[model samples]
Target: MTDNLNEFNKGELIIENKRDKRLDNALLTTYEGDTLLSCVYIEHNSLPELSIDDVDTTTTFFGKQVPFPLMINAMTGGTEQGVEINEALYNISKELGIPMEVGAQDVLMEDMDTAELFLGEIVEEVNRPTVLLSNLHANSSVADIKVAMDTINADGIALHLNPGQEIFTKDGISNFVGRYESIEKAAKEYGDKLIVKEVGFGMSEEVIKKLVDVGVKNIDVSGSGGTNFVEIENLRNFDYDFSELYEWGVPTAKSIINARNISKDITIIASGGIKTSLDIARALILGADMVGISGEVLKYLIHGGYDYAKDYLQELMYKTKIVMLLLGCKNIEQLKKTPYKLTGKLKEII
Candidate 1:
């Protein structure tokens, strides 16, 4: 049996077949339904003990101090334009003092020389770092995972589970066998550096417990209601319609609560349909160690380029500080302890 040149890599294949279509589809689908962020009503403090100037909105990732807990989540990569996108993202991540998880790096498995193609030369050539993170599929081998991480000297690596998105993709894989074992192996090898993540399909407490049981300490519960990948893939496939499943997966707010209840130790990144500073505040209140934003940042990047995206993020972070002040929470720790109630759909879920 000979290897098919055209069918070599799923990451490459997804890029080649779709090119900027994925980016375009993502931008188009940035529109989201109720993320249940509305269900989170952070109690206001009539008497905030500390002044706005004294609020400490600081956190850490990769052992480096960040101004806030916001993170730049995975977007697109593994193409020429992807290289440019990554560079811009690097700039923004550096300016904002936050961590960024790059898009899929499975393409580098077949061609390691093209590391610059997937992660950008900026990452390869930089002296000062931005707490960069590499990403790969869940079932990747330890060898493959190492190459992806070592390619750009990533501080951490995110192993993403996107079975819901895959089922909708025309050329996506169906065999998820050994996924748990593969994750366990990566965790054993990488330990605290390995972050198990979901795409837009969200995560359940059961799923998070499985990861926690495997010794995984970082989890990005990229819940539903952002960049509907099912709709994106189904739109690409003229052969069939998966519209009915477009709304699948847990809401972002509830997923945060789920992870918070499961364990106090694991780092939970609340993402999916995160559109505002209040959303960021609500996530922290519900137990997310940090907040992640992808589509909204991508929208800002596409609409106005790097500078616009940077300004948007800076403002978002500033507003998150303001939210902290309003809640009478001087720091991220206080914000987490701030009382809030879950109502509506999210109330029923938890």
Candidate 2:
């Protein structure tokens, strides 16, 4: 046990290798299936008297006024490269007043010293009230969850449920028997501060109900149509194939509606394959209080560096406001009340 811990701390070789490979694949890989954003289109208001100048993009999330209802969801953490990515994203978050969740804390849980050398230093350097969230796996204990949150001084903690990813991974843990029990314990202990979310597979009404039953108040419906973990895992291992499950999971738009139908009050965060302003607007109309983005930002940051990524996000914010103006909705609240129609495959799914 001591030797294993020492090896992890020595160079974080395992996580570093995984992180590098995932980053490379994320750049080249294209996910299968629809995000359902294309299936639903927001109604254009011809008589919209609202001007772009009058549109307000600010919305309250995590009990604070965020410039927009967007969050940079968990991406990478726990290695040298992970630290660099976290630092860049953190600077962007600070500049944009956007919320971000640091990548998974598996390494931190395995070796505190490794995390101190990788994620902890960056967290300490960038520590501030920027709506930072700590990320943990679903099977993590409440104690592990607490340590992750405290490490980053997280405003909240996002426990990602990636059963599909785990099931498909070559040597990943497949035992999710007590995941709900873990979530329930965390929710009871932290209440609204606990965000129970899926990795890329959308949450169904049943999943939402179970989470709400466990006292969870925030849910990120990170649906398919983005970075397909099944695909990623497949890329990781060529000896086995899982292509048959490429299009698995619910679409983002439908998942948001499903979550809304289950509970009117749960703070729904729409994510997965969210790239354009139309996607964000459609998500808001479908009952998403917030939208989480990961792949798009990572792509931008990787290809174009920090400035390019920042500019891309700024453009998204602009497009979202333009969408609000076009919809004749001056604010996010009004946008939610705006009417929209589902078409094609999305309507069929509904």
Candidate 3:
């Protein structure tokens, strides 16, 4: 049965067709009723009053200077349709002058031809000085990590932790038990390049400390309140009884706060459920070095096409500028040190 499921998972049907449906369902389920970041409140009263024009949005990551502290998070690859999506995303990223990350490179690691055909095309198309990020699952070995990174000429690799997805998916790979040592080993071996990331489920202060102890300098809080991978996997299964739990995990704002409280040295990339420039501003204020956009970008591209996505990105930039001006922030650094008030669940969690 597992073999059959593996075959079912391998074909183009899984990613090409099912992927869209999964994404749609995940978005609907995650953001259907209320806003996740609603719990966070910006205190304009007690905080220093500033204008949006004063905000400086420039930021640096991994020694690369980014015009804005925003990255298009790893979205899709390894399938034929994924190539088109990647091209569209890369084009937007290039136009916006922000860094971008490719989807998981597991397929590339297994098949060099696929890497050249898909990932290589993406790199070539986005011929700008964008920060290219490669990806691998946490369970991947040191060799797998190296291959995944080298496959795409990644500026850095995002080692993702998705135990919930692995467990929830039908025919999912079990025994995702030995990631700590593997992460440590990968960090030691590729400390120069890899950026460890969490998928949906947020990382805690304790987890951040452990990763720091293991020599990780970069961490992406791909926290919850965005694309619910468990929900996506559950949609794929259709038989899961715990579908409601898809709404589980950390909100992007809270995750940023936790990350900031734990380690000031590690680069924090806020993701999971990020939509607007206000969300980006909130993340930066909460202590994220950069913010990641995925599901929203994909939705824009699917419904409104590439031009629409570009417009959306431009609007986001405008919103970011407005936020910075209002905060009187001259740059991304100032935004980070800027004061923000937390309320609701976020205040409790923080």
Candidate 4:
């Protein structure tokens, strides 16, 4: 594997591939479908009184105190358009005092110079003590990830496991052999800085245990009910119809519970199809320490622009606080203990 920029040009193509596919999906498909988060309702407190001004939304993760638990999930970066999108997202993250993860930096491992010149420059411009997270493919080794981390001074690295997405997408990495081995090696080297995540499909309790065994302490259960990569890839490949697998993978709420059942010590990052403040509140109630929003944030940036995105995020944080006050919960820890009933399909799944 030559580390030439030309060789890595193919990897850059994949970034474009994902970006185009997602845009098309957002335009053509329906995002109105429920994330199933509506099933978990927070118990409303009528008699209880809590000052809305006193509601604290801040939470700690990766040894940093983030103003909010919301994370701008990895979106784009490789080309000129990607840099523009990253710029908007970076600015929004900085303004909101929340964490943001860059899209997979596998491009950097292949072509360091180009990635650094583009994405790295955006990170440098957004430079701060914020909890910026880096990302890469699950099969990436420790050395490959080190380059990604160094590119942005990442507080943590997310290795996204997307066998389902790859299996369908044209030119996708079909061979995920030795991926777990790579994860083990990276975990050994990075310790708690390593985050094993799913693309859209959620992880099972069994898989969570395996990752825990490999010394993984942070897990982002990027479950289904959000962006269906299989459906997106099928949309990319016009000839094939993979719609049968559209509702595949565990829902985000269920996935969080599954991971919680497996380990209480590990940090659980709930993501995938997170659309509203209620969704964020529900995830926290179900044991998620942090929540990641990709499609929602990117959609705002693409459709409404930077200022719109910032205002939307600010409103979301406000709603999250309102939910807390309504539940008589002052902080994230208290919110976790807030009583709630799980009903409908979610109950069956749980």
Give, for candidate 4, the lowest lDDT window spanning 10 residues. Answer: 1-10
What is the lDDT for 253 in model 2?
A: 84
lDDT of 2 by residue, 76-182 (tens): 77766666667677778878999988888878877886665334355565446568888888878889988888887788999999998888888877788998988
Clashing residue pairs in candidate 2, if any?
none
In candidate 4, what are the lDDT values of residues 1-350, reduced to their tens digit?
11222322233433444544555465455533455788996778996577998888888988889988998888766655566666667767877889888887777766766565335455554447578888899988788888888888788899999998888787777887898999999999999898999988899999999999999999999998987788778777766787877878888988899999999999999998998989999999999999999888766666555667788889999999998998898888899998888999998878
What TM-score, to 2 decimals, does candidate 4 have?
A: 0.91
Backbone collisions counted per model: 0, 0, 9, 0
lDDT of 3 by residue, 282-344 (tens): 887788888888888877776666777778888888887877766666677777777667787
Question: How do all models score by TM-score?
Answer: 0.92, 0.92, 0.87, 0.91
Give the alpha carbon lDDT tens digit for every residue of 176-287 in model 1. 7889999999999999899999988788889999999999999999998777898888778888878777789888887887788889999999999998999998888888
Model 2 stretches with alpha carbons more than 4 Å out: 1-19, 116-120, 125-129
Instruction: Specify the highest-lDDT model's number.
Output: 2
Score residue 186 of candidate 1 by CA lDDT.
94
* Candidate 2 similarity to native, TM-score: 0.92
Off by over 4 Å in 4: 1-27, 31-34, 117-120, 125-127
